[model samples]
Target: MQKELLKWLKDVGELDSARLISECSVDLLYVDTLFEMSSDRMTDLMDAQIGIPGKYYLKLQLDFQKEIKIIETQLMEVATALGMHIRSISWNPKIDTDKEVQMKISIIVRQAIFDEITLNKISWSGRLEEPDFLNRIFDLSKMPSFDSRFDNAYDDIHKHRIMNYDWEDDWVFTDRRFNLLHCEEEIFLKFLSLTINPVSRTDDEGVGQLIEIYNRNLSESGIEFYEKSKIAGKPIYGYREIAAGNASTSSADAKQRKIALVVGCSQYEFAGLLENPLNDAVAIKQNLESLGFDVMYAENPNLKDLKIKIDDFGTELEKYDVGLFYFAGHGVQVKGLNYLIPVDANLKSERTVEYDCVQVDRILSHMENAKTSVNLIILDACRNNPFERSWGRDLSQRGFAVMDAPKGSLIAYSTSPGKTASDGEGKNGLYTGELIAEIKSVNLTITQLFQKVRKAVMEKSKDTQVPWESTSLTADFYFNRK
Candidate 1:
């Protein structure tokens, strides 16, 4: 879904940042310190009236009705669909931000845009003259926009809103002449969903043919589509990876010194217990050590021990040219910052986040202090613990926030930002399993290694989990280089 649309509201004065979370709720931050307000601005804010979700603003009853309306207007401009709504505007009365601190403005959009739009992912790029998939599945000639004889003003007006106007080209044969052969990944998946949807097309025959065609040609690429579920005897489809990993014995040469800190937290006291992290860590440690890394491994460490190990890892990293750190456990993003939960973490509520868990930024800071030339931070810590949702509707985000890899470093997440990766049924989690196998490849750069792992994870998890990376490394790195 178009989560980026919420940014338009930032144009409204005094808005510091806007975030869209899992529940489709929009949380806005209004920092009093960042920008200057009018001399009587605080007085006006105190006098304002917020009509919808009661008149509570930072321990004071302030009428913010005027400000809320502007935000709602901006929401309408971005969300084109009919279902989106501003269910309520909630501000906790306990917070007293009067002393020039950031004001948290909470807004709930029921049946949020992202929730409404769920698209299955399958990768494909064809070399055909026309989109053969579309030719076989759809009869676009039936659409009103198909005819080139008429120039409708309404259609013209709609076309101009987009950056490139040849979209869904009903008339001339531009790149859009074919059905989604040339389109954004989102649009492509949307079209693919429509093709297999029981309501969209009653004919199961076309869906069958499409799957057969896809698999026959895409087998070498390791992609396959299959029936995920059935609706009233009609089939619903999803795709998965179908290939095996190639084995490699060669490890990185000893020209450059390398060290790795690997931590896996599986054992837990009450909640957030995971199955495969311990196994994942052991496997990674073996792999890194074989590849000439001085591995400092920890499994099921409590909060105190986890911090001590990380600190020590940083201190010892000074002797190495390239350093790597990997964690496999429960992780959450409170507000926008990421926290890696130790096995002993008792995350009861939002307030306990800072005290109970380790901030990923702190780890980055430790790495920065060492001044390591090349650093890699791999986190396979995004298993959606049941307690995370039980705590509160809006509290405890699902996964890690996308972070910029520090200079000379690359940050690889087990799953994409704002999404959780699957805790696997096998010895390791779905992401770490792929990562373990892919790192064995010779001469593949750190960037290439992660991309291959991302593809494998997407295939294995049926697009539910895709790994992500942010890199700023100047030189190439590998497990085994030529």
Candidate 2:
């Protein structure tokens, strides 16, 4: 039986030479039981001549399960170290039985990595190779015994469009290779179902009926199918259409209508003014404009004027798919509520801040209420509090307070909550300077962009300042998608 199983594995190219030998070895202690049972009867003597195939088959399945689990654990550790998210890793035992277990693992890579793979046409044949970061995590060579079921589903989905439609409206349909690399859940599952039980012409009545029943059930529970699919796969990062009003526009038009509001308050009437805010704001505005945003630049606005501009910004957000707001100035937190102070504010007491300053929640409310698909708010407002000494009151906090991010929105601070950020000795602040450089990087997702920025800021500040962010975004976002 062991020889037969080894031959079968070799013919299928499932297990490598090293693993096959390790899995086939049986313990000598179990063979003693068979020898002792031979004296019972003639039938028992005949049975002893040939080993039990079922026992050996069950043992092989257990060995495969153990090896696959080890591989999965190693892949997970590598992915976590690289700051990647793995949505699912599973092996199916029903379809191929012990001969070849079907395995599927889905991971969401940064845009840079994804683009490199797509452009270079990298094939993951279960071997560790170049692009060492990805290879380290997804070493397919370790699990050569398991068939990559998801890869076949990805290939089939690429060849056939969903429901025979040409997919002119979907951005993923533009390139077959791109589509295969970043396929959504519903499409992959549809192809997987078809692959498992293909429709054939010479099928018997029972097989045809079973296929019909499967199709009928799939169609009947469409909502449930999509929900289940979402729970299993990695989140997609492609350009999704605006849900509320601009759903009919072309992709090019949607990309062109991106809007940003850039505000920098430096020239203060009552408090000591900072030198780098204006430079930081201008640099940020220029970078954003280069990335195709129609920026509304504001320099040193008063409290009432800032409110007016914010109201106008909220109105403009309705017209765009992506809305970003950036502020570089002084801010304070009073009684656990964060406030962005204007240039003309006169803070006599803690109670006066409520009326003199703009609440951080106001900006978040506008974003949460807007029809935009993605909203980003960056505040480089963590400089040392100018009002702390003048007011002669200990606010119990030095810098900006932490705030939770609304759904579909992200809030990024120049430094961590309650920590002061340094206005750099150069033209721009440390956080904004690093951010401007990272934003120009090719194919960086929002999370990856911040990770790079955080690293640079920490290094430049010599571990004194650490940037922080709060995100509740469900889908992936990229600053530079191409």
Candidate 3:
């Protein structure tokens, strides 16, 4: 059975070499496997040995990081036919000082099938015997019966991974396996059943139909497989074209209609001046413009000017599907209400803040009343409150107050509520600098973009500062898409 399986794997180009090693009583199977293409140089050394009377140890070492879930799925089918139950699987990175990193996967299995005559004599000195039925399982003629579309699909996925290698921090080996299983569920299920239960009613016609359905679903999902399959001269199903059309429509909708209002107050009359607000605003304006937004930028705006700009922004929002508002400067919260301080505001007491500063609620009202489909409010204004000492009240808060996002809107704070964010020694603040970098990541969705920004800020601040957000958006939004 082992020999036949090894031969079939070799014939199918799944492995580069296979050998049976006799080190002890039981025969050990060692195979060198390859994935995608030979040029990738990703090799796996699989060692299968019976360590105990009924238990088996399977150790796999890969020369480079790649998906092993497919291998695991195949092995599970093999074990099920042999009446073996997998106990556990573990993964570890084996690092060498002189060489690149290698990933090691170890799996333990225990046998459940018991025939007294066949089981009692299974010892440590000879090869474990397999029943005649088990030995006939690996029929070479049945190998090509499995769907071939999976080969192309997986190749496309691998190529996509290679193309995005530098920016894909989230696409780990685990993610690849997950996408494979979810994206090609029917094909994999049919393959597994055919391999393990050959006597079942699986036919070529049925398998072909399953492959067709799988192909249709993959195309509709807008996954890498669909794009690659098109280049390979394969016919795309109906739903894929529909999905592609919808995507095109969305892109056209966003092209010239997205709007953003950026306000940065650096010079204050009563509050201390900040050096980074103007620079942050300029950088943000450039980034948004690059992403195809009509930006309204303001620097050193007073209370009256801020109100007029925000009101104008509200009027502009009515004609757009996406609206974004960004503010960078002094901010404070009194009595649990957040306010953005202008450059010319003079807050004599807590009572004066209501009339002197811009209320965050009012800004949100502009977005809500404009009826935009998506609204993004970014506040890089959570610096230390400069008027806290002069308030003569218990208004000694560190930063802005926490507020809930209205429906279809997302509000992001420079730092956690009530926590002061850093104005970096560099030209831009910590949060905004990280945000600027992440916004330019073409493939990331808005949520993913913010997650990367949060991670960067935390790491750069050494855990001293953390960004926070409140979101009620029902649909996904991306700054840049490909």
Candidate 4:
């Protein structure tokens, strides 16, 4: 890329910085006023003799000792923005002119052009200012704290138009000049990507946090900033356009919009207490959290409080793209409706038990109301209801009623409808234990994730318990995609 940029620069022979800016349509608004003045100071900076078109070299005074690093970095940026490369900066030395003797540092460089991909490959779509994403950037760019970052971005991507333009509070007076606020999508994305790079962030925590904030908005435009790798615990960020319905591996991490809620009702008040529900909830919660979900966990929650948590979770789900609900406890089915027994339930009779317990459909209702991109409802509560003996119910079905999964949802059952699932002799239930194990595997989509769990459970249970899923999912999903 640097070679090509240099070649492009060489083609435009004997060019001055002003001409380069005007021809290339660079944006100069982001440049510091004093530095912009220097660029404007044609007599000292842009004169052809000093900024000579020979193997990329820069000539600067050695007087500003303290600001030397700052000035050198900025000048190199100007050199770069003008499609030129200033390779190295050497100390001042005696110059041999017929009538003068002075010291001036010389840095060799080659002419350059902005990357072709950044300049012409991607055409401008809508106005760059149309998205609110830039609002944060614009505000931050003007702050004193962010000077270290925006300084590099400004000089790295400046443009030329009128040789002398007015100024307003550091803004270029001529709106006609190309500026950061009204550049192409390519430049906007490239500029933003540079700001979040580990080198640009001064090894601060801002890179990670900013990437999260940027990706949330960038994804709406079919692009995202991803952590390409890490350097000393800091993320090295990059950007790419994402295909529709197919998010990248970086999209599968915590920066994306995803959340989970896990509940366990083991400590019963009037119903038979179970052992593995709490354990199962913890297992699922841990796995989901590890897979980049903001998991909300509930243990031994009562009907009233659980309902409130469900409502809150639903409201919160509005802000996320994916939502998951996992429940493990004693469950009962009557008249083809499933109920999850709460720790505070009083199941005196089959008729009133519906009022005492939590309905499975209520959870689905909240997920749907939130309008999430995907919803997962996993039920490990297909246990025998102790009330069946007292009610004298003698049907073949012993567990939850069968139902179809809703649109954009995938519901998982610990056992096929109307079958019982063992709470297990170990810390976790037979179904949840396998599910957690499979969730740790990367590149497994939602359906594939459950299929593996079903197989694992089937083998472990010796075909006594078969996990099942009902999915109406419109897009593929991964718990830990790579």
lDDT against the true structure, per candidate, is: 0.61, 0.60, 0.60, 0.61
- How does model 2 fare in lDDT? 0.60
Off by over 4 Å in 1: 1-253
Per-model clash counts, in order, read: 5, 2, 3, 10
Candidate 4 lDDT by residue in tens digits, 297-342: 8889888888888888988999998999989998888788888887
Using Cα atoms with residue i matched to residue i, what is each candidate's TM-score against the true structure?
0.50, 0.52, 0.54, 0.49
Error of 1 at 284 (Å): 0.3
Q: Write the per-residue lDDT of candidate 3 for residues 1-482, one digit (tens) a residue.
A: 23333444455455522222111121223243345464754333333432211122233334312224433344444544443333433433322344522111111110111121123332111221211221233332323212254343333333443443442322321132222122233332233223223233233223222323333233323421121122233322222223445678567645747999999989988877798999999999999998899999889999899999999999989999899999999888988999999999888788988999999998899999999989999999999877777766553467877899999899999999888899888999999999987898855557667766887999999988999888877555778766
**Model 1 — which ten-residue stretch has the worst lDDT?**
42-51
Ranking 1 against 4 by TM-score, winner: 1
Candidate 3 Cα misplacement greater than 4 A, ranges: 1-250, 392-396
RMSD of 3: 19.6
Q: Where is the poorest 10-residue window by lDDT in model 3?
A: 104-113
In candidate 2, which residue ranges exceed 4 Å CA deviation? Answer: 1-256
RMSD of 1: 25.3
Q: Per-residue alpha-carbon lDDT of model 1 for 124-203, expressed as tens digits? A: 21222123334344453433343364354234323432334544332221222332322333344444555556654565
How does residue 154 of candidate 2 score in lDDT?
35
Q: Which pairs clash (backbone N, Cα, C closer than 3 Å) in model 3?
A: 25-124, 25-125, 25-126
